[model samples]
Target: MLLASAMTFSAGAVTPGGEAETIYYNARVMTVNDHFDITDAVAIKAGRIMAVGSHAQLQELAGNDTRQVDLQGKSLLPGFYDGHIHVGTGPRPFGATFNVPTPDQLTEILAREAAKVPAGDWLVGLMNRPHCHMQMPNRWELDAIVPDHPVMLACGVLKLTLNSKAIELAGLSKDTPEPKDGLIVRDEQGEPQGVLTMGARRYATRVIPNPALSDDSARDNLRAQLAKFLPMGVTSVNIAGVRPNELRLIQDVYQRWGDELPRATLQIFLFPGYDDVDTSLAELEGLGFRTGIGNDRLKLGAIKMSMDGAIAVPDFRTLKPYDGKVRFDERGPWENQKGDFNGVTVIPKDSLYRVASRAHELGWQLGIHTIGDGAVVEAVEVLERVLREYPREDHRHHLHHLTIRPPEETLAKIAELDLIVDTQPNYTYYNNAFMLAAVSGNRLERQNPQRSLLERGIRIAYGSDGLPHGPLLGIWAAVNRLGHDGKVYGAEEAISVEEAIRAYTRGPAYLTFDEQERGSIEVGKVADLVVLAEDPLSVDPLRLRDLAVERTIIAGQELFHGSHVEPYHQRPPTP
Candidate 1:
C-alpha cells in the first residue's frame, strides 16, 4: 500500500533545483522513504539529493554540465548504519582470523606466536569464542608452552587467563585488593589462579605494552579501519564505549579526513571502571558538551555504561537464578560456579540509578548495556522514574545488547518510555548455541525479539558490536534468525528483509537524530547510498549476506567502487 502511494505521489514530487551536478538512472533505486519507495532514477546536486523518481521525471533536473551514469540494472539503497560498534579495536594479536577459534586452535596459534616473539616480551591472545567453548589453559599449562613470555589469554572480553610472568609483570598478587566491579579468581589456598573477570581484566591489559605511532600513522589506521565498512554498504556507525583520549583521536581523524571516514557518533564510556560518577559528570559539565555535539560526519553520542557482566560468560545479571543444566566441554566460567548463579551486576544499583537520573537531568543521552532481563528491568524502572521526575521528549536513551526480553509489563513500559534498542542481531546468530546452553529455552526464544518490538511501536536498530562488524551479516542474521548450528532459535521473532534493512538504515539514523538529513534518498538528504550487484529485496533471503556492494557514495562522492562499477574518482573532473 505504501509503495503504491509512493509511485502515485512521484508524479507530483518536485525536483529541488533546476540543474543537477549528476544524474544516475537505469537502476532499481530503493528510496527507503516513508513509503519504502522504489524509484527509477536519482539526481544529485552538490552533496545532496536533488530528486528521485522515474528516469524521465528526473532528467528535467539535469543540465549540460551534469554527468550521467547508468547503473546498468544494479540496485541502489540508503547506506547502512551500524547503531553500535567500536573504533580502534580489532582482532587480538596472534588471534585467529576467524573471530571464534576453538580452544586447541587458539593454544597452538599462541604457542607459535610466543616462539616468534623475543623472550620476556608480553604475548596477548584474544579470541571471540563463546565461554562454553573457552576451556582455557591455566597459568601452569600456558607456561609449559610459552615459559619465557608473559602471556595473557582473553576469552570473550570479560574473562582473562594470565601466566605467572604476566601476573608478576602486572604487579598483581593474592594480597592485591580487587578493583571495583572486577574480580580476581582464586583457588583453594586463596592464591591468585591467574584468572580475572570484568573490571579485573584491565590489570593485564594496562600492563601490556603498545606500539607508539605518530598522529599521521594513527589517522591513517583510523581511516583504513573505517573504510573497510564502505564495501559492506555501511556509511554511518555509532562507536560506543570510547574513552576521552580515544575520542580526541577520533575527532582529530575526522577533522583532518572527514570525507574519507564513515559518519560516526561516539558514545563516551563512563562509570566506576573508567571514572567515578561524580568525576564523569564533572567532566561532561566542564566540557560543556552533551550528545549531538558534532556535525553529520562526527558527533559526541550518548554516555554509555555497562549495567552487568557479559552474556558470553553467562555472567550477566538475571531476574532469576540460571537454569544451570547445560555444561561446557571442559572447565569454563560456569563449569563449577557457585552461589545462586544469578550473575553479577557490574554497576551498583544506586550508582546506576543516580547516574541515569543525573545524566538525563544534564541533557545527556544514556546508552546502557543491559544484556540480562534483570538489568533490562532495572534500566526501564530507573528511566521511568527519571522521566517522571524530569521529562524530556525524544530523549532517545537507548539500551545496548538486550539479549533477553523483559516481562510484558516492563516491555510495555519500554514502549511507553520510547526507549530505543541497539542490539547485535549477529550475536544471536553467532552465539545462539552457547546462549541456549547458558539460558533457559524460554529465554532463548525471547532473544532478539525484533518483530515483537516493532509491533509494539518500539524503535530498534542493528549493530555489529565489533564482532566481525558487517551490516550484511547483521541483516542476514535478523531475517534468518539462524544459529551457527543451523537451528532457528527464535522463529517467531524473525523479521522480513525490508524490516531488517530499515533497522540497519533509518532506524539507526533516528537513534542518532539524523533521520531528516541522511536516512533516505529524499530531495534534501545527503547522497549517501550504496549500489549493489543484486537487489536485496529480489534475492533469496538466505543469500542476503552474499549481496555485494558495487559502489559506495557518501555526500555525492564515491569512496569505494567494486569491480562491477567504473571508478568514479578516476574519471576526469566534471568541468
Candidate 2:
C-alpha cells in the first residue's frame, strides 16, 4: 500500500526546474480530445505529460535532462484499449498457434500431441476453433483419433470441444445435468456431442490443470501477453474476464507488473449465480481499496456479468428469432424457442438484477455483457434502479456486446441512462463470417449501430474481444464494416476513421474512469501513447491493418522501441 501511494505521488508531480523526463518531437500527434486536436510535440515529466504544442513550444519546456527523440514524421496517438478480453491464467500448453480449418487436420494434430504426452496427462490446446467437417467436432470424431488422452482445445470467445477421454475426465455423461447458464450441445440420443458453451465450460475448467497458478505464472503470462500487446501498440487493457478463482494470482501479478508492463484495468467476472458473489465482493473489499485505487499503471475496473451469449450461436436472447432459413435452426443443442428465434438468455433476469444491484451498492462500476436488444433494455432497467437509489450520475456503467442490433427504444435508453456501449468493432468485420446468411432482412440494420448511437449522444468505446486483438483491425471494422466476403454489412453504421480512433482511445479511457489522466495527447495526462509507422487518418481504410507501431511509450518511457521491448521507467525519480 505504501508503494502504491508512492507511485500515485510520483506519477503526477513535475520535477525540479520543470524539466521534462522525455520529449517526443517532429511527429503528427493526435490529441484525441473534444476538438480532435493535432500537435507537433509533447513533453512529459514524472511519467505524465507536461505540455503539448508545436515542436518549438515543447522544446522550450524541455531541459538537458530530457531524453529527446525525433519521430521522423511518424504519427503519435494514445494507446489502444481492449474493453473486454480473457487471458488464460491457468496452465495451458502452447499447443497450436495457427488455425485448423478441417476436422481431419485437428484430429491429426491432436493425435500427434497425444502421442508425445503421457496417456493420462490432459492435453490442453489453445488458439484454434473446434476444427470441424462442415460443423463443430463431435466426441466420437475426437475419440477416433485419441481415445486414451484427454484433449481439450479452446477457441477464445467461441466454444470448446473435448475428446471422449476429456469428457469422462470432466464427469460429463448422458446423466450429467446441463448448467442453467450454458448449453451442452447434445446429439439425438441425448448424449453430449462435446461442445461446451459459455459458462458450461465449468465442466472442463474443473478438470483442466491449474498448477495452482502461482504468482510467478501470472507474472510470466502477463509478461508474454504484454509483449504481444506492445508490438501492436496496445498499452492498456481491461482484463475483462478475470474468473473468481484466478483473481488472486492476477492481482498479485498486477502488483508486480503494474509499472513494468502496459497499463491494465481489471473487470472481475461474476459467474452465473453458482459462484458465491459475496465471497468475491469480500475479496475486493479486503484489498484495502475499491475501483480506481491504484496508480496510473493499474486500477480496478467494473464488475462483468454475462446476460446473453454469442452471435454465432444466435444465443443473444433476441426478441424475435433470426429471420433466416435452415442456418440457426440446424442445431444439436437446446432449440427451445418459437418462431424465428434461435437465441437464449444465459443469466436469469432476476439474478442479473440482484448481482448488479449488490455490486452497485458496493461501489463498483458495472459492465454487463448484453448482446441482444432485449438484454440491453433489461440492463438499462437494472441500472435505472441502481441510479435511482444511488444518484450517481457519473457511474458510467457500460453495456458490452449489443451486437444483436438494438432497437430505437434500447438505444434511446442507453443515451438517456448515460451508459457506455463497449463494442468490439473487430466482431463487426465478421459480419460476412456468420449470421448474415441466417439473419433476418431488417435485423442487419441494427448490428453495431455506431452512427445511430453517436447521433443520440451515447458514448461508444471500441474493444477487441480477442478476435486476433488487433486495434487497427477494429478501427477498420468500424470505418468500413466490410465483412470477409467484401461487402459492407451496415453502411449506415460506418463512422469516420477519427471517430473510430476516438472510440479506441478517448472513449475507453472514460470507461476506465481515467479520462483526465489518459485518452489523449494532452497536458497533465499520462504519456501512454503509440507512434505509428504512418498516419492512420491519411492511410486507406482497407490498408489500416498494414499499419505498424514503431514505438510504444508508457509513462514517459519508451517501453517499446521499434520491435523491441524496454524496461520499466524506474518509478519516475520519486517525484
Candidate 3:
C-alpha cells in the first residue's frame, strides 16, 4: 500500500511543520474508502489529507493562519486515475485541424488540410476511427486528396494509410519486402496501394521530418491538453508510450510549474521500434527510477508494451476470421490478406517475458497492451510463465485493452494469476457502432466483457485511452453501453455507476500499485480529488457525461475551480 495516515493536529490549532499547507471544508465528500464513507468536509496539511469527517469536526482543527475554502455543499471525490494514455507524443497534432468523421469525412478533412500546407511538406494527420464516431479513410482516398505531398494518416492504433508520394519517398514499391512485423497493402495488379499497416507505418513516419516545436511551443501545446482535461475533472494521468527526450521536457516543465500543473504519473514505455528490451529496461533503471517514484506532483510508474494490434483494423490476432461479413469459408482478415497478423509485438514475446520478469525481480510492474483474444491469451500466458519461473509476489502485470475475449474463463485465469485488466469502457460507447459494422457483427455481445470479468473476480480498471478520455463519458458508456445508432449493445454487460467509478479510481490505483496513496479519499492519503457539479451516482446514466466539474484539487492545492471561482496555487511555508 502506497498510503500514509494523516498527521494529527489539535482542533482549532495550526501546526507549523514547515511544509504544512492549506485545507478545505464544507463539502459533500464521498470517500470511496472501505466503508464508502460520505462526509461533510476534509482537512489538509503538508499536501496530505489530514482529517475527513463532518464540517464542524474539520473546522475545529483549522489553524489561525490556515487558508480555508468552503465547498458550499458541492460534491468531491478522488481525482481520476487513467490507467492507459499515449502521452509521450503529447496531444494529437490534428486536434484543432480536424473533426474526423467516417472514411468520407476523413477524406474531406485530409483534402482540406493538404490544401492549406505547402506543396512539398509532408501532410500528416491522426484520425481516431475506433472511437471517432465516423468512417475510416483509406489510402486510395488520401492519394486523391494530395497527389503531390507525401501524406501519412494514422488511425487510433498504428494502422496507417499513405499516399503515392509517401510510398515513393519511403522507397517502398510493389517489390518492397515487408518488414518482419509489418504489412504492405497492394492493389489487385500486384502494385503497392500505399496502405502501410502496423509496423510498416514506422518506416514512412521515420523518413518524414518531425514538425519543429520550441520548448515554449511544446509547453503551450501541453497546456492546451491540460486545459482539456481540467474541465473533465482529470487531475492525474499515466502517460503511455513516451520517449526519454519527451519525458525530460515534461519533467522540466513539471518541476518549474509544480504548483500549477495537474498531478501526473509518467509511464515511459520505450518506443516500439527504437529500443530493445534490455536497453529499454537499462535506460529506465539508469534514470534512478522505480515503479512509483516522485511526490504528489509527478511520479514515474510502470513500463508499457504493445503485445498486439487492435481488432477494429482486423490486424489483431483473433481466433475467428473477420470477412467483412459472416461466411462459411472465411479466412482470418490479416493472415491470408495483404496484411500481416503475427500481431506486432513491441518486443518479442520471449524478450518481453524476460524483461518483465527482470522488472518484477527489481520490484517494478509491467503494463502490456493486448487487444485481441489471441493477444490477451499470449500476454496472460507470458505473465503466468514468468511468474511461475521467477516467482515474484504481487507482480501486478496489467493487460491493456482486452477488447474481445471469449468469456469469464480467461478472466478467471487472470484472477488466479493475479493479473490486472486495464480496460477502456469509453471504447465500447465510441467504437460500438464501428465494431458492430466492421469486425464482430452480432457477436458484439461478447466484446469488452466487463460484467463477466468483474463477476469472475478479475481485477478490472478503467481508462479512456484519450480518444474520448473523459471519466464521466466512460462512466456513461459503462452504465448505458450505448451504441452509435443510439441503441444499447450489451445491457447485461453494463456495470453500475459505483462499479464504474471504482474501476477508474481504486482499480487503476491497485494496478499501478498506488492504491494506498491516491485512489480512495481516506484520511492520511495524498489530497488529490475532484469536485464535480453533481453527484455521479445521483445523476441519470444518460446525463453522466453532461455532468460538469466544479473544481479539481491535487496535493491539497486547487488546480482548477469552477468558472465563477478565482484561480490560485498555494505553497508550503518558506521558513
Q: Considering every candidate listed, which one attains the maximal lDDT?
A: 1
TM-score of each: 0.89, 0.87, 0.84
- Model 3 residue 549 distance off true place after TM-score fit, in angstroms: 0.3
- For candidate 2, lDDT tens digit of each residue in 1-575? 01122212234455334667777889998988788888778777767777777777666666777788899998999877766666775334333333454444776777677777787877776534212211456678768877887777665445677878888888988889977666687777778888887767889878877655556766687667755787778878887767556666666766766666778888877754544556645654554444676667766888888887776554566776666433432254324434554555676677777777777777888898887777777778888887887777588899987776777787787888899999887776543334453354667655766888889999988888766577888888888887554667778888999999999988888999978877887666777899998999998888787787788878877777774322211111000
Worst 10 residues of 1 by lDDT: 566-575
Worst 10 residues of 2 by lDDT: 566-575
Backbone N/Cα/C clashes per model? 0, 2, 9
Q: Model 2, stretches more than 4 Å misplaced? A: 1-16, 62-65, 91-104, 118-122, 127-135, 168-175, 208-212, 244-248, 272-289, 312-314, 324-341, 430-434, 563-575
Better of 2 and 3 by lDDT: 2
**What TM-score would candidate 1 get against the native?**
0.89
Locate the minimum summed-lDDT window of 10 residues in model 3: 566-575
Q: Look at candidate 3 and tell me the lDDT of residue 281.
A: 64
